[model samples]
Target: MENRPKVGIGVIIIKGNKILLGKRKNTHGEGSWCYPGGHLEFGESWEECSRREVWEEVGIQIKNLRFGTITNDIFENEHKHYITISMISDYESGEVKLMEPDKFDKWEWFEWDKLPSPLFLPTINQLKEGFNPF
Candidate 1:
């Protein structure tokens, strides 16, 4: 496989004082908690990818998009690399429901300091850098 860092987008949808997150399933970060996001598709802008991923993952529309944080996540055990760009947005509408049952087991909002354990690598790195969208 060609060694190239894939571009990923993570959207931190804000609702009140909580952020949206999901427990990953059947993927590289299986069992870890993560934001709604995925690989950036070809010819898509950062905001476009952010919007698409959030909707595709959890059936929500987001507004007030702003740049949040970036992390170079290297999953050594999985032998995968990703440059993750996190975007912060206000939850515009729609109920938070799992759109991809195969990829995520649960979706919920959590306070920043009360996040679930075994967070995805990009999330872990972002938090370590003290990146907070709140």
Candidate 2:
């Protein structure tokens, strides 16, 4: 098939001293915890993608977005690679809704250091690079 890195956008919505995350299912990083995000559509700006993904994944709104970090995630087993761009934002409003029940089932907030185990590749890579979404 194709052999190029896809641009993925990840949003770290901040609420109090916690960040939002979900347990992925039926995807490359299945069973791993990850932030709300997805592929960046063509013609979409980084900020646009961040906000869209967050709302699409979980019925919530975010604001005060700031550039966070990026990670070159290569899922060797899945034969997929993504240039994951992370964005940090403050939780503006709304409740967490499992909008995509097939993709994710559980969504919650957690302290960065107390994050759930078995995080997705992009998340692990970001952490390794000393990403501090504070």
Candidate 3:
């Protein structure tokens, strides 16, 4: 068993009245809806990780980046722990494209109150804490 928790970054890309999320296809949170994000790379700041992950996963650039919230998620079934920093950003440029088909099915915009079920742990926590990026 790992003794340390992993660090991750989640990006909340707000457009109009909707937020961007993706249906996870593979890995730990498979079959859940989540925001565009990934593991925080070594030597990378949380903001940098947010930008890179968002661009890598969904092929979009984000601006007006700001700290949203943080969640300590423990996936008991998957035996993984993560300290996720949620970052808020507005959609700036680039079209919404699935840059990682193997990792996610597709990306879509959804209203906060009507988000899809089985949300990722981090996202679930964020919502439960009333972390609204709008």
Instruction: Specify the highest-lDDT model's number.
Output: 2
lDDT tens per residue, model 3, 1-134: 55899998889999988999999986998999999998888899988999999989988888999999999999999988999999999999999998999999989999988999889999988887888877
Off by over 4 Å in 1: none
In model 1, the Cα lDDT at residue 62 comes to 93
- For model 2, name the residue pairs that clash: none
Steric clash pairs (candidate 3) = none
Residue range 13-127, candidate 2, lDDT tens digits: 9999999999999998999999999999999999999999999999898999989998999999999989999999999999999999999979989998898989999889988
- In candidate 2, how many clashes are counted? 0
TM-score head-to-head 1 vs 3, winner: 1
* lDDT of model 3, residue 118: 89
RMSD of each: 0.8, 0.7, 1.1
TM-score of 2: 0.97
Candidate 1, residue 106: the lDDT equals 90
**Candidate 3 residue runs with Cα over 4 Å from true position:** none
Clashing pairs in 1: none
Error of 2 at 99 (Å): 0.5
